[model samples]
Target: MANTTTTTPNAAQDTLVLIGRALIAYLFIPAGIGKLMGFAGTVGYINSVGLPLPEVGAAIAILVELVLGIALLVGFKTRWTAIAMAIFTVAAALFFHKYWSAPDAMKMMQQINFNKNIAIAGGLLALSAFGPGRFSIDKK
Candidate 1:
């Protein structure tokens, strides 16, 4: 008699991947919503960084964080979304969380945020390489 097992070894892995995606999305979705709600403030913050075209920067950030974040949460185009998010996270860390140049009073917090962004980016890159697990829309 042949064994008939429907469950794959990847069940746990898929659950973990889904959870990871949700966690990552949780970080960005609210942030994107906050930015959208406070568009003027977001633009002001971008301008404070002396980046050119602050409004454009804010718009792009909103699109990436909100749209791609949703895509990631749902496991849609997971690999590409993860890659884009990784790039965006790194860029944000460099531009907004520049700990090296931060004032002494703010240095520690800035460093923490910068490191967090880098870690998130690393996770995203890993997700991109591994692909979304069996639970993801990409797999289905």
Candidate 2:
């Protein structure tokens, strides 16, 4: 008799992991592309937030979202890339999404964004712990 339960779950696990990677990477790719397209505006925003070296910050953001993001989507060196992304996510949340200090009108939006970043970071940490699963380049 076929051991249907075990086999199905493993296949499902691979597909789910791939989907998770895709969704997470999807968020970054468009964001990175937007930054590339609007470099000056991004720099202005970064500067407004009082981050040092807005240009450098923008560039690092681009690299993390586009370059490292692609690597993550492909599950290439998943754990390392996930860790980097997790760190970046936390830093960005702290730097850019300080909703607690925002004026009332803007506070809600910033709070949502801040919480979202934390959630994404949590997902990245989970990925780092689980690896890329069976279908990934870092296949377990």
Candidate 1 residue spans exceeding 4 A from truth: 1-9
Residue 133 displacement in candidate 1 (angstroms): 0.9
lDDT of 1 by residue, 1-140 (tens): 99887555378888898899999999999999999999999999999999999999999999889999999999999999999999999999999999999999999999999999999999999999887888778888
Clashes of 1: 0
lDDT of 2 by residue, 72-123 (tens): 9999999999999999999999999999999999999999999999999999
User: Which residue window of length 10 is worst by lDDT in model 1?
Assistant: 3-12
Every candidate's lDDT: 0.94, 0.92
